[model samples]
Structure formats: C-alpha cells, structure tokens
Target chain A: MNRDRRQLVLMLMPYLVGLVVLVLLPAAATMAMAFTETDLIATSRFLGAANFVELTTDPAVQAAVGNSLSYLMFSVPLRLVIAVGLALLLHRRARGSGTARAAVLLPGAVPELAYGLMWLWLLNPIQGPVNQFLLLGGEGGRTALGTLPPQWLTDPEDARAGIVLMSLFTIGETFVIVLTARLALPPEAYELAELEGARAGQVLRRVTLPLLAPVLAVLVLRDTLMSLQASFVPTLVVTNGGPPPYATTYLSLVLYQDAFEYLRYGYAAAVAALMLGLTAVAVLIQWRLLRRWASHGIVGAGAQRPGN
Target chain B: MSWHDPGRRRRAYGAVAVTALFGSPLLLLLAGSLREPGQPPVVAPPLIPEDPGFAAYHQAITHGDLVRAAANSMIVAAVGVPLSLLVASLAGFALTQLPRRLASAVIGLSVLAMMVPATALLLPRFVLFRTLHLTDTLVPLIAPALIATSPLYPLIYYLAFRAIPADSYDLCRLADLTPMQTWRRMALPQVQPVTAGLAALTFALTWSNLLDPLVYLYDRATFTLPLALRALAAMDPHNQPVFLAGAVLTTLPTLLVIGVAQRRFMHSYGPEGAP
Candidate 1:
C-alpha cells in the first residue's frame, strides 16, 4: 500500500474498531443471544424460539410496548412543533429574543438525572408547585376551573403525560439545528418575499416550510428514535414503572429490569431484538413520509456561507 | 426590533411567556432545595421560604456521599470526553482524505450505528464487560468514550471539516505537512466553535449519564453523580429537599460548560442582526 493508503488506515482504525465492537458486534450478538437462556452465571442453553415465544404472551411486555408507542406518538410531534416554533421565533435578534433563546436551550443543558429529579418535584402532585398553584384558586382540593389537578406520579395517564412534559423543555439540540437551517437559507428568497410584501404567515407557508422541509424530515426521523428510548431515565427514577401494571413501563425499562434486575439475559436480548425492529419500522415509516424533503438537505448542510 | 413597535412588543411578550413556562422547573428545583429541613411536603407553599436554609445541601453532601460520587463523575468525564473527541476528530479528518465511495460507506455505517439506541445494546455490553471482568469497575462507564459517546460526533466533525475549502488542503500539501500534521495544525484550528460546542455537549452527556452506572455498578464507592442522586432519593424518599439539592449540584457544572461555549456557538449561527 502507498503512504496515503497507510495513513488513511492509521487514522480510520480507531473508529472502525469502535463501531464494530460497540455497535455491530452487539447488534448481531443480540439476535443470537435471543435464542439462548443464559444469565451470565450458568452454562448457556439454547432455548430456540422459547424466549421469543414467551415474549408474545407476556402482559408486561405488551404494556411496555403500548406505553413506548404512546410516549412516542405524543412526545415526537409535540417536541418537533415546539422546537421549530422556537427556532423560527427566536432565530433572529430582537428585543428579549436572546433571553428566549437561552430559555429554549438551558433546559437541554441540564443533565438528564437532574432534569428528572426536578420534574419529580415539579410534578409531585401533592407538594409540587404545579398542583399547588392550580389549587390556589379554589376552596376545596379543586382548581378555579372546577377541575382537579393532575396526579402526575400516582395516576397512570398523568404519569405518562408528566414524562412527555419533561421532554418538551429539552429540545435545545433540535432548536439549534433548525435555527441554523433558517439562517443558512438563501437570503434572496426572503428578500423577494419582503419585496412582495408577504405577510409573515404567507411567507412561512409558501417560502420557509418548503426550504426547511429537509431539515425537519431528518429531525423527525432522529426524534422518533430518541423518543422511543428516552424513557429509561424517567421511568426508572421518577415513576419507577408505576401507578402499577406497567403503565409507564417503557421498552427500555422492561429490557433493563429483565437483564439487570432479574438477571434474565436471554429474555432481555429478545426484548432488545423487538426494540431494534420497532426502531427500523419507525424510521422507515418516517422516511417514506419525508423522502422528498430529506434528499436535498445534506448538500449545503446549513453551514454558514459568505453571502448570508 | 425595538419593543416600542407593536409587532416587536407582541414578540417580546411571547418571549416572556416561553421563558416563564419552560424555565420554571429549574426555579422549582431551587425553591425545593432551599426549604428548611424536616418540613413536611407542604400544600401550596409559598415560592420563597420564610427562612431559606442550606441544611438540605449539607445533609446531601455528607449523608449521601455526594462528594465522592461527584469526584468519580469528574474523573470519568475528564478522561472519557477527551478520548472521545480524539477518536472522533481523527476519523472525521480521515474521512475527508479517503476516496469518496469509501467515505460515504463509512458515513452510512456511522448513521446506522447512531440509529441503534443505547438501550438495545445494554445486555450485550453487560455480557462483554462481564466476560472481560470489567464490570463493577469504571471501564464500562468509560468504554463508550472510544465510540465517541455516540456515532453522531464523527459525522458532525465530517461535515464541519468538509466545509473547509479544497485550496486549504492544497496549501497543506504545498507546505509538506503530513495528513496528521495538517489535521492538527490547520483543520483543527479552523473549527474551534464546533469543537467547543461538541466538547461541551460531550461533557454534559457524560456527566449526566445514569444508565451505564446503574447497570454496571453495584458498589456505592463506584457510583457516579446520577446514581448517587438516585441512591439519595431512595434512601430518604420523604426528604425531597435533600434529593433536590443533589439535583441542583448536578446541573450547575453542565450549565456552566454550556454557557462558556454558547457565545462562540451562537456567533457561528450568524453575525448579530441577521435580519
């Protein structure tokens, strides 16, 4: 090999080894391990399809799957819309926009564990300021709207909603990307929109959305995967898979419990296999939905240019 | 852009609303931490305590063993983040040098790797570490650094490095610089904003990571900050203030790191007054 080839290999060796060892090997091993009954202590026994068969009948698995899908359904769209809205609103300098921008990003800067603990207090349902503020207006345990406050920790539905609520504030990464995309667009289009005296809504509909579709498409795909697995921390820390019967027990929690708590490695590997399938299906669905938009987003990649 | 104009005034109001709505949780954390110790979970307590105190923070640090856990967290992040950046930046620069097809294939593989969620790999990693007898040690926690914490970092670096003009590489060749030399001296210096932003994120993520520590570690001595915080809550479920204090301590460093990088990062988005 030439010097260039040797140099390239030398540089690429670490990443290639890392990708294979950390990702590819584990992925393939998960499939194989799904067939065996091993708990890291005993001799491995090939269970054939038994682990997968049991997965089909487990109510816990069923509930975990349902919770994950519901979490994904609600959180992904809400996060996307909010992130894009914030990016569009605060992308430019104006009075107090920097504060708004900082507000948008600061929650994301928070560590997940810290953020989870913060929500544990904020959504405490009893002593939590959220419910307390809601209850302040009424005589009894009701709010001024003649409704009761949400039981964010105890009630099943509210426990799920609280997780999604915690998720909404941490869209800093998404906001930054969308803001850069907005900035990177050819200024001539916006200049033309201004020359034509386009209303803000009109410009958004006709000019901005189409240009940003590509970036949004990618965010949708990435956020879909993120929303699915993002539940591990919250469910573990705040909810503990509770308001029980696995209401907030997402797939990650299920996999975590099966492998780590129960020491059922093979069964957890099967759950992991199912998660991989879910991820593929989710990404494929979004890809088909947004194929046109994603195709052209990478060329310029929202980088800063010389001429605005 | 002045708030005196009607349109701008409406937006300023909008800004205030989001800043209040989304930013209130941190305030709640702060308030809960400041309450006097031994107080019951109060109903509709005032936002500020009549007499705020740091007794909860004191309890959290001593009884919760937070100082040791925090030191462990610092050790992991300090060692792990730089290693991650090194591997990611090297492969990213190498991508710029590789033939286009090979580079695209590698990039495609990297994207696929990113899509595989960390949860999916938990058991295999556990088995791998156990087989190597690295469990209960800090190696499992730090091993992810070799993968750049996520496969996404290399791709981000690839995009940033590719944005540089071809003439710069030509200049490097003319100056008799090797690939590694050009990468360190020329390419790295040009993309300080991206490096700073990515480093801040990597640090924050590493510091906050709870899952690996939860799975691999059982000894209290090896627990990182998040695990220690969880243990604090579990130890005294009724004492919410102590755990809240622990949460506050975890957030400050991550926020400070991001604040240091935010100005350069914000400038990279565009010069001020883009409109």
Candidate 2:
C-alpha cells in the first residue's frame, strides 16, 4: 500500500517475467507434452497414460533406470572421496597446488564432447595408450576398450563405470566451490589445534572436516541433479546407447533418440517430463537435507566469526 | 612454515606425487596424440614427442569449419556475457534488498533453477524457439542469456552482491542516490571482481557449448567451435591425433580464461572471514 511496497513490486516485475518465460513456461510445456502423442507433425491426440504405460513397461527404460542408479552409486562416492582428497592437498598448498588445481580444473572446463572423445580413445580396447602402458606390449597387451574395457558405454555395469570415469575428469566446478568453502574456514582454528599439539590428522578431523561438511553436501546435491540430465555428448561419442538394443539408455538419451532419431516428439516430451520430475525430486531431497548448510555457507559467514 | 622441516618436506613430496598421478591422464592425452601410428609405443623417456611436431595442430587449424566456429563463438560470448551481467546485477540488487521472507523465496526458486540441469530445458526451449521463428538463428541462443534467467551467472552475481556490506547501500541512500543509481555507482564497483570471474566462465561456457548450435542451427555456416570439432570427429574416427588436436585447440581459450580468473578467486579467499 505504501511507497516501499509499490517500489518492491515494480522492481520485481522484470525478474518475475523472466521466471515465467524462461523457467515456468518451458517446464509447463514439458508436462503437457508428456501427456500427448504428437510426433512434431500435423495432428496430435491426447494419449494420456499410454505414454506413461510405455515408459514404465519398456525394458530399455528399465535398464537405463537401473544403470543410472548404479552410476549414482559408484560416481557419487568416488567423486566425493577424490574431490575431498584433492581439495585437502590443494588446501595445504604443498608445492604445486596452484598448478595442480589449474590442471585438474582444466578437465572441468572441457566440454562433455571433448572429454567423451578423449575417453573413447583412452579406453579404446586396442592400442589405446592406457591399455598399452598397462599391458607393456606383452602377450597380455590388448585394447582395454575391446578386450577388458567393460561394456562401460554399452553394458550395464561397464556403462555405469564409464559414466563415472567420464565424470571423474570434470570435478573442477565442484572442487572450486569446495575450495571456496575450505579457504573460508578460519585459519586460527587450525592454528590453535597445532598449538595444542594436535596431529595433522587430528586437526583435519577436528577442524577441517566439520567446516567442510556443509559445502560437500551442497556439492553432492547440485551434482546429482545435474547428472540426471546427462546425455547428448556422452551418448554421441561412445555407445550411442546401443549394443543390446538399449543397455546404456538414460532418460535424456531416450528423449533425444525419440525426438531427433525416431521423430517421436510426444514420446520424447514424456521422457523429458519424467526426467524433470526426477530432477525436481533430487532438488527437494537436497534442500531437505542440506538447507542448513546452504544457508550457513552463504549468509552466516559473518555470524559464525567465533570460529575465527 | 620452514623448508628445513622434514615433516613439511615430506608432505610437500607427498602432494607432488599425488598430483603427478592424478594429473597423468591429461599428460597421457598429450603423449598419445603425438605418437605417430606404427611407431614403437613407449610411455617413458620423454613425455614430449621425439620429433615434437605440431602436425595435429596444423591439421586442426586448417579444418575449414574451425576458424569460422572460433569467430562465431567469440561473437556469441561477447554478446552473451554483458547482457547476463546487466540483468543479473539488477535482479540481484533487487533481490538482496527485498524483505527477508520474500528474498528467501526468490533465492530458493533460483537455487531450484540451478539444481535442474540445463539439458532438461533444451527440448522445450527448442520447440519454443521454433514456434517463435527464432530456432535457426542465434537469437534463441542469446535470448535466455540476455535476461538474468540463467541460473549459473545470476547465482554467482547474487552471491557476490550479498557478500558486499549492506552499509554501503545505506551510505548511497544517505547520499540521495536512487536504487538504480546506487547500484551503478556503488554496488557495481564492488562486484567487479565477481563479474570478471563470471565473465571468463561465461565466455568459456559459450565457446565450448557443442549441443545448442548443433541441434538448433540448420547450417554448417553457423557452427560454433565445439560443433566444428564434433564435425571433424565424425568425419574421421580413426584419427585420434586429429581429434586430440581439435580438443586442444578448443580448450586453449578456456585455459587462458581460467588462468586469469583464478588470481581474482585467490585474492578473494586471502586472509578473510570465510563469512
């Protein structure tokens, strides 16, 4: 009713417009598309439940869902441990941390397409430098991608591992955020622990780990959601979601295949909508679990100065 | 702190060994790219090639689509970053100044936006752009970026603005400046470091994006750098050397940008309240 209130509404208008157009509208369209059977062609009919039925009954969809679960199982813990270890190493600035950080971060900057291609070659069953070095040109020498490379891009177990390995290279964005959280911790806390004759491990346990827990939780939540929609580049470069007809098919890959490959716009939209729903659930779970950490990391910086 | 300390030295050596191990993949990439087909494969001796030639780089450069893609990428980034900065700064300033409950809601929504992967948005965005007659053009590519609608840049700017002391805004108000003027004169200067960091990242993202143009654009003439590399890869799957070379060329500008941005981040993290 007053000037401040009026001013607030006026200022918020632009952002509100953006939200409607950019976020809300597209999301709504996806939901609507999920319910139909239009192939991006002339006429479309409402085929509610039919698309949902197929999505659930489809064996390829089941395998993809299973592989995605396996991927989360392997990738999350692997990345968390590796990321924390690397962060700790860089945190101490032990000779070459800067350069190490930069190098590690370089992979994150690389597009998925590039990284996928690199892996496609690196994991190549024959003559890949990785397999070659491992085998040392003996009778055991064979292309890892061909002989022992696991069906990473194609087989269920291997495809999951492949996804994890591909993702391993791009931990930089998370590493950076975690580094920010680590650097933000009060050095005096570590200083005091040292003065008290604490061992390095003790200091890490007592001081660093608790301080970093919040950031790590935030990183996990963010990455999990991002991982759900992971497709396009990886699919294109490696398996193309093939071999057993549909071993490595993720929801996004399925959507792409349906839309671009099969011209099944209605089916693609349905898949897209499901993926969006999963993403939403992931975000909700993250918020419920990590809201305290997110708030403290962002807003409680000054208030938590006692640790200083 | 002393180099004479055996413990410190041991830790330093430990760090180096770990880094060398972790960093080997990138090195392996370089070495593998350089090894000529049919040559005896040796992982040791020199990580550098015996001849140390740039044949792969030469081929990558001469690829017809690459140069044009680079130009297109530059244009896309050059236009995208500033537009995002302006809109994000405005929205961030407004959001930060709002009432506590309202601000939390906005922040929550934005965080939710960030949590949803960008890939999920692609399909609807493509259809929407097509309906609007903007799909084949660069307009759809740049439009979402023009608003502070993107989660990544806006989120960074929001955090940066929030980090600045609120009293500065109060001081501006006391000086008789309007909110817009206050943002431009006071808040904008403070957030410059954050903007610069975001600028580098935005540029890198724009340059390396492979999917958007590949799907949206109808012609090779509009291809971005990553798409150019993808085209090359599709053309020759056997030439791992050429693929690696394209990857290198694609990543060079990104490395430079990250190099410049890291200094700002380091400075920001130096001797401060983590808050």
Candidate 3:
C-alpha cells in the first residue's frame, strides 16, 4: 500500500509542478497584485480595493463592462439561433451537402487573425464590396462601415452587432459540434415522428431541438465565455477599440495594455483576476444548468471505462 | 429528363442557382485578389492578370520576413504538437488508472482550464514568461504545450483520448511492452485518428495565433505569418489588394493543410464524430 501511494505520488509529480508553475503561481500572483498598486519599476503598495472602486466608477471600464454584457446578451442567442438553423438546413446527407458544409466550416479553420484581417478589408466602408453591393440597392446611401454601416468594431451599437456578425461566420465550430449531436440522435425517434406525418419544423421543434438542447447550451456557454474574450485580433484590427473612451475594450485587451504597454503589472493582474472570476461564475452556472443535458452517450460503442 | 416536369425542373434550377450564388462570394474573393487595383472592380477579369507576374508571391518571399517566421512557427508547432499530445495522453491515461478522487480532481482542473478563454491567460502568461526570461523566445510560446495548457489542443486530445477504452492500455501491458513501447506500439496506433486530429488542430492554433507572438516578440522579423499580415495591414489599411494578397499568402498553407488533413479527418472523425 505504501509502495502504491509512492507510485501514485510519483505519477502526479509532473502535474503538480506544472499546476504550480503554470496555473497556481500566476493565479496567486494576480490575486495578490490586485490589492497593490505597482508599476514595473517599484514595489507595490497595498491599495485595499482602491482599484476596484476606480474600476466600478470609471466610465471606460463601465462602458467596457456594459459593452461586454450587451455583447453576450445579443451574440449568444443570435449565434445559437443561426447555428441551429444552419445546422438543420445543411446537416442533410444530400449530394454535395457535406462538401458545402466543409466549405462553410473552412472559415473557422482559418486563423482568427487572418480571418479578422480578411473581413477588415472586405467590410471597409468606402471601398469594400459589401458596402458597394449594399449601395446598389439604394438603401439610404449608408455604407457597411459608415456612421453606422454595420460597423463591427467602432460604433457602440454596431460594435456589438459586428462582433455578433463576425461570430456568425465562425459558426463552423459550433455547427460541427451541433451536427455531430444531430446525427447521433436515434434514427428511431425521427422515424416515429415521420410515421406521425409531422412536418419538418414540428419534428425539429419537438424532437430535434429538445434532444439537442444540451449541446446547444454547452455551445452557448462556451461561445459566451469565448466572445467575452472578444477575439482580440478583430477588435484590435477593426476598431482599435476606438472613437472615444474605448467602447470595444475587452477585459483581456485591457489587461494586456495595463500589464505590457503601461507596465502596470499590478493593474493588469487585477484585470486578469476579474476576468477569471467572471468566467468562473459563468462556468459554474453552465455546469449546474447543463449537467442533465450532457447525456449524449459517447460516440463510439466500446468497452465501458471507470470514469467518464 | 426533368425538363418535361416544371416543378422538378424549377427545383433543380433553383438548386443550381443557389449553389452558384453561394459559391460566387468565395469565388469573387479569390478572383478579386488576382485583379490589379487599376482595373474596374465590377468586371469579371482574368483568372491570372495579363502581366501574370509573380510580384505578390515574390514580394512575400523576398521583402517579407515570412521564411523566418514560417521557420519559427514550424519549430514551435513541431515541438508543441507532440509535447501536447504526450502530456494529454499521460494525464488522460493516468486519470483513468488512478483512484477515483485523484482522477476527478485531474479531470476537473483540465476541464476548467479548457473552459477558460485563452485571452484570460495572456497577462498572467506574459508576466510569467518575463520572469523566466522565456519571453521573446520560442520557449514561452512552445512550452505551454508541454503542460497541456494550450486551451485548444488539450481539450481536443482529452476528448480523443476519452473515446479510447482502458483495455487498450492493459492489452499493451499484457504484451510485455514498456510504457514507452506501449505508447509507441499500441496506444499510439489506437489513437492515430485522434492524434491526426489534434496535430491538425495544434498546427492551426500555432500557425494562426497572433496574440502570444505579438506580446512576446518585439522584432518585426520574428513575426509569424499572421503577425506579419497584421503588421502589413497596419502599414497600409487602405491598400486593399495588398491586404488581400497578404491574406491569401497567410491563408495558403492552412488551406493546403486542411485539404490534405480533411481526408484523414473525414475518415477519423466520421460524419458522426465531432471535428
């Protein structure tokens, strides 16, 4: 028994070192730094929630927080709706549908930075084809990146809209996840619905949607946390978080600027901790709500294992 | 044959039209890159310009720091992918082998790390790397893989490993294989599909990542393709064709990689499994 314990401890040694050096230490450092005020050159003085107080009252932080929340409110449901609709529409095994699905998903595989840059040019207000095409319809002469030209990165209203729209193109990841779940649905359930002479939409609502709800929730929670990161490249390139008071500043970008650019290590650490707290709360809620929906029965049928 | 039937023919025509319409955007994007700026934007022009010069490609090769960045990226990826695979497989295997309590904690931590957006790690990681003197080198970028802290690859490998049965481990042990031998001769073969999937994913993540290198590397010459492309975009946002050209160059490798990997992916991740 002693030998077994030793062996087990030995096995865990690497993980422990890794956890301490990579995760725990950083977490501890960030937590401690949150209470202090230090630039790179000097020792930090304990500030005792002064930073948090400032964070609460600062209009920039407030706008950032509001923008993030509003972004979540809009993007999550919109992505869920569009992803499910697209998955349902394209999940068929018809000729060339798989290829079509692959093509649509190609956008997701492209690097986020590359895709962001591509869209930056493609959505340019004056020169971009998107706006040019929009103008052809004579829709009040508003360009796609004009004062409110679906400005995916600038105007506050349009920034939220743009983030959501940009997310729409990357639905390949969510689409594939949902597609697997949709395919895994027992054919018998659909067969019964078909026998009942149910319409497609009815079967989708009653059978497909209900069964896939768990995966949908997972996707929503996952994307919400992800978009909370706000994809730095897009925001950085598209808006530069600009125009005034930095409306598009995500928690990560703010942290990055604080730590690296300004060398306010402590402030950056505080931002990191806040972001961590936010994700933790969101994740906890998701875990509690999503436990029931996780029953997708693993994909491959095989010998049973001890722990999932 | 369907011409005699209006409804069938109309549906067929509609399918064709939709395919063409949907396909046109991608095609136009590709076609637009090839067109010079002086040409009228509306007209469908040559697939290759009249000059058909390799100017963009040449510029990308000669003037751009693409080769070095590509080298750095490859080095990072080559080292990082295997490191991630090994760490994930080890933790995954041990989690299955260990007592219930330890396993749960391990799994919990892994899942928690996976769920946290990688952006959250940037500040902490930059600070950590700075202290270690690993910042600015490939180590900071690559070493994250060794710990399975790469938010993307670790989750992918964990899912893949989970799909494998515990019996595979026992089978290798019973065959008198050493742990290393077992990994090579048995477990590796069984998880080939997942390995391929994770490999592609690791490549995608490494190749496309702009944040880490941007933070760590100060010199423009050290920039990866994505970083270089971003730099190019910043230099001249108004030069539309130049941006497209850079985008295409940046996109080419991954596109080719996906084309090749898609077959393996299709086989491994059946139409039924998650990508």
DockQ of 1: 0.64
How do the residues A213-293 of candidate 1 rate in per-residue lDDT, one tens digit apiece? Answer: 768878988888887789888888889999888879999889889988898889989999999899999988877666544
Clashing pairs in 1: none
Superposed on the true chain A, the predicted chain A of model 3 yields a TM-score of 0.83
Off by more than 4 A, model 2: A1-15, A137-139, A142-156, A191-197, A284-308, B1-7, B32-52, B147-149, B270-275
Better of 1 and 3 by TM-score: 1
Tens digits of per-residue lDDT for model 2, A212-288: 77567667876687676654478667767765677666776777777777877777777776777777776687677
Segments of candidate 3 deviating more than 4 angstroms: A1-16, A139-154, A287-308, B1-29, B37-54, B60-63, B115-117, B149-159, B165-170, B176-180, B269-275
Residue-by-residue lDDT tens digits, candidate 1, B1-275: 23224667677878888788778878878988998877876776787778889999999999889999999999999899999999889999999898999999999999898878787788788879988999888889888887888889988999889989999999998998888888999999998998998999899889999989988999999999999998998898878889889899989999898888887787776574455
Measured by lDDT, the strongest candidate is 1
lDDT of 2: 0.69
Instruction: For each candidate in turn, give its C-alpha RMSD to the true structure in angstroms.
Output: 2.7, 4.3, 5.3
Residue A302 alpha-carbon offset, candidate 3, angstroms: 19
Instruction: Give the worst 10-residue stretch by lDDT in candidate 3 chain B.
Output: B1-10
Native interface contact recovery, all models:
0.69, 0.30, 0.25
Measured as a fraction from 0 to 1, the native contacts recovered by model 1 come to 0.69
In terms of lDDT, model 3 sits at 0.64
State which candidate has the highest DockQ. 1
- Measured with C-alpha atoms, the lDDT of residue A239 in candidate 3 is 70
lDDT of 2 by residue, B127-238 (tens): 7888898866777667666445366566566677787887887798688776667678898889877877777777666666766786688777787778788888888777
